[model samples]
Target chain A: MEGLNTVGLVEVLTLDGLDDVVRVLRDQGRKVIGPIVRDGVITHDEFDSVSELPHGWTEDQDGGRYRLVPTGTDEVFGFSSPSTSWKRYLYPERTLLIRARRDNGTVEVVQPQPDAPAVAFFGIRSCDLVALGILDRVFLDREATDPTYAARRSDVFIVAAACNRPGKTCFCASMDTGPTPRSGFDLSVRELHGDGRHEFLVEAGSERGTELLATIASRRATTADLDTAQALHGRAAASMGRRMDPQDPPLAALDPDHPRWDDVANRCLACGNCTMVCPTCFCNATEDSTNLTGTEAERWRVWDSCFSIDFSHLHGGSVRSTVKSRYRQWLLHKLVTWHDQFDVSGCVGCGRCITWCPVGIDLTAEITALATPQQSAGRKGVPS
Target chain B: MTPRMYEVVARRDDLPDTVTLTLAPVDEQCPTPAIGQFNMLWAFGIGEAPISLAGFENGHLIHTIRRVGAVTNSLAASTTGDQIGVRGPYGTGWDLTRAAGRDVLVVAGGLGLAPVRPIITELFANRSSYGRAVLLVGARTPDALLYRDELEQWRGRLDIEVEVTVDSATPSWRGDVGVVTRLVERAPIDPENTTAFVCGPEVMMRFAAVSVVDRGVPAAEVMLSLERNMHCAIGHCGHCQLGPEFICKDGPVVPWPRVKPLLRVAER
Candidate 1:
């Protein structure tokens, strides 16, 4: 009752308006970033026009494997979500925290004011919006708000493209964040096209989106169009190949001696790739880099992973010295202790960890194993 | 608040690699720090490290730093007139007021005494409020002992019992020998009515905690300071996490029962 914000307005858009969403956001003085193929991978980066969008591209994503293949249909939102998350834009990997310039006698130390430019997303997925929400709770919800993240997140405008083509690795249904997001975005778009028809069912979740949708010229959606969109969504939800239980017993609570722990440990290299790609992992460490003459120094907060042995280092030595211990900490932290710390779940089940991991670790299988003692014991070898 | 400029008013080399820097803010009034809470001291060109407030006297705050790494070494090397930056009187502090009318047992090992020092000062300043107070300190050797003169003054007090022990002492050394945990067994205090505060290396704290708990002191009455790799005192950075708790914000001074499970796991 006290701290909640008033809900944003809602509206619907016609099919043709999907192409103009970026232009509308840009006219509002916001820089736009969207999906693009870079170095043979579908990733989110700065883009100028819709032509730069990865058209006709769909991704083949399995555990530890990802490939961008052409779908033969000219579709922009056909692919799975990328390896990079909205965190790269909102809660940037590197941030300048403090700067101390030493003159002759006095040292002027200032908390550097963050320069945040308003940015809009062209095609953010529902899982990404959920990840952003989780980050908001961590940074903005706390008493000591992270000044950097708060400044950047304030003016962010999101345009979410609902997942109609779920990736092989996608498990957003299990995480309860998507194939479709109920709310938590400025605008929602379901790109429905096939068999000589090309259109998008756009729904506004915020006043900004409602105003922007009014600028694009398109007809009101017929009842038939809405029915077609609903059928497409139902089919997509069923097509999702991956599934995970966020709170599977023994593993979700992370029973330490569960034999599966040792099996996962043996396969886990502790390379930190999973954490790097995980949408909800927010661990960071601060470092100070001094100038050559050493008169001035700047404190930088950098991206850090729990898998690194140096992460748990205290005075004597690392608390998690072995690969087994480190892997245990990372998984336990994600599935179990994170809930204890944040109240909300840490994972959005985007499956980036599964697709990006070099060792092909699937969290869905890991969670399923914890269902029974026999299953945990049976899965001894790492999935190929 | 961000770190403001502070000058090293005076410096004292208490031991070979340990030094105490008495700091005073260059401009504004620095707030009084609480017992068991720490300050993130920045060494001009080097990084910041969290050091417990050793003492607060007159217009200066004293921090006894051990030169273990780059940041602390730079801070320990700093002399009078050198300027450094300080922020935060951060994290939770000891609950000395709750220990009123109860015997207070203070156990410290080596640099661990730095954090427990403030509690001792508070106990002495308001001696009538609390029951009998006992301080048992332990170090690696006789030379490693800190605050020699103040320890003498505390020993002279009729109201307090101060005992010092070193693992190995020089031939000239004269005091108790062995670990501080051993001293807790024979310490003069009412165990049932006593509150124990411990700060030390993790192994030593665990043993000291067991000794006090075995003496009939409830586990809830035992307070221990947890140390970790603290990068941010405000708890944004994830370096200081111990299980679900962040050592910087949730603790540095947590009740033993609260952290007992976290402390029990070797590599959690």
Candidate 2:
């Protein structure tokens, strides 16, 4: 901590050292939120003790399928991200934009400042962390900065978890987002289980993380420990169930009349589940609510999806009306058009949409459909 | 973080369901709007809508709004001296520099004439900067025509070619009758050197673009002001997304070929 580089300082952490890290985070007035196994899914939530982590449970995720399987591993983090992303925190589904009160002569418009809580993300997955980075570019780096996102993102600490065991729906390797996040983390923790011992190899990725790790780092990592940790991440990378075409641009340069769009549209419900769970999809619509008496009014920004008909609503009607058009918009927006706007693909390959989708429509397959010539008899059934 | 306070100084009924309101900034400084640029007008207790600058009479900012939805209804209903909020003279506008020595072709259909009003204002102010100018206007009916008196006065000018058409004309009407596209023959423009600007309903713009393009104007030389679902009049809100472009940020005014394929889309 005294004279260390602000980034990339790896250290060994024991079971007790993990507890110390959480304690230090909380002691600094930051609300520590981590993973907890509840009801059947491993979800990110507020937790104080490391004991709350899904200890021996790993998630099995296929297209339109998810299950909390008992992996029998005594490691803390054994699952990838759930349907919930850090977008819930950084960019809330519903955010208050403006508040107005009818004065004696005129309406006093009040654009309210956000109430940002000092919090630390305790167990952010590499995929979700990548999603946060994309959100940062959209909300912070854009022309009109979203004050709500800036407020929530400014003071929060990110303690990301390297994917030791990638979930069944994960394809971070294809997207080049993870099994290991490149940047935008205060600290990153990788879990390792070897010849009869379980331990964590934590790395301080920022100045604050370095300072915090000074108190919790049990020992500096030896060569053998580093190799074990690297192997674990390599295994997770190789084990992804889905593989998007990292070679071919996801949906770049698509023909407007591509038949693949029609095929996917037939299966797509247009329910907006993909956009809702997707880590990088950031389309939204604002709603205005007024209390009784019609004196005070408030405007709130709610998460809207490209799949929703009203997402592209104009003066007379919606811009994208048909399911085929809606799906086309979503796919093109995420894969191709997003590159033109943000200079990056919108999807992080987290696969929340793949698992959460009730119809089991996979972008990997859809993108492949666009590339491959249509077969005489198309492959049958959804990816479940 | 507060919206600039502005008061409506004057209101002119341009057509049925359409009014041109002139606004004067109160304590806030409003930037001079370029032709084809728009402002997000906020109605107290209601919401905001992006309306194009329709030129100014004196020093006030003018916006011609058609009562389409909620925000516009509030604006269209606003009386003179009523208070309203304003933000942005946002997005890139029509580059008059590109059309500097070239002929200028302005096409307007129905309320689309409102946004192009600024261009006409600019043309009249600097009559010699541009080459031959023509304004082709189309309306659903003779009664639906906007700024009828202004159109008559402008037509009197020997400098500009102003041809007006109606889809359905009355017996008393003496001018051209038929679609605005048909008037391309009447307003003989040197398409090679003419830069066309179109604003209207999507279908009208599409047909107008085709006719203008057929008249020897390149597709890229023809620009159209687009309408998309814009929430944040910046790039943040995804509502205004059109293919690779954000109608709010990248355009509102864009070259035809950039959005040509997208315009062919039924829903989007």
Clashes found in each candidate (C-alpha, N, C closer than 3 A):
0, 1
Q: How far off is residue B37 in model 1, in Å? A: 0.5
RMSD of each: 4.4, 4.3
DockQ for each numbered candidate: 0.43, 0.48
Question: What ranges in model 2 sit over 4 Å off?
Answer: A1-7, A373-384, B57-59
Worst 10 residues of 1 chain B by lDDT: B259-268
CAPRI quality of model 2: acceptable
Candidate 1 lDDT, A1-384, residue by residue in tens? 100132533334434456577677777788998899988888888776777888889999998898888999988788877867878787788988888888886888878888788898778888888888888877885667988889888988888887778999998887788777667777777777888887777777778766777677766666777677778777877888787766556444555546776788888878899888887888888788878987788888888988888887766688878776677677777777777777777788788999998989887787676555643332222120
Per-residue lDDT tens digits for candidate 2, residues B58-79, read 5578888999888899889999
Q: Candidate 1 DockQ category?
A: acceptable
- How does model 1 score by TM-score? 0.94
Per-residue accuracy of model 2 over A159-243 as CA lDDT, tens digit each: 8888877877889888888887557888888887767887888888888888888877588878887788777777888988888
**How many Å off is the CA of A253 in candidate 1?**
3.4
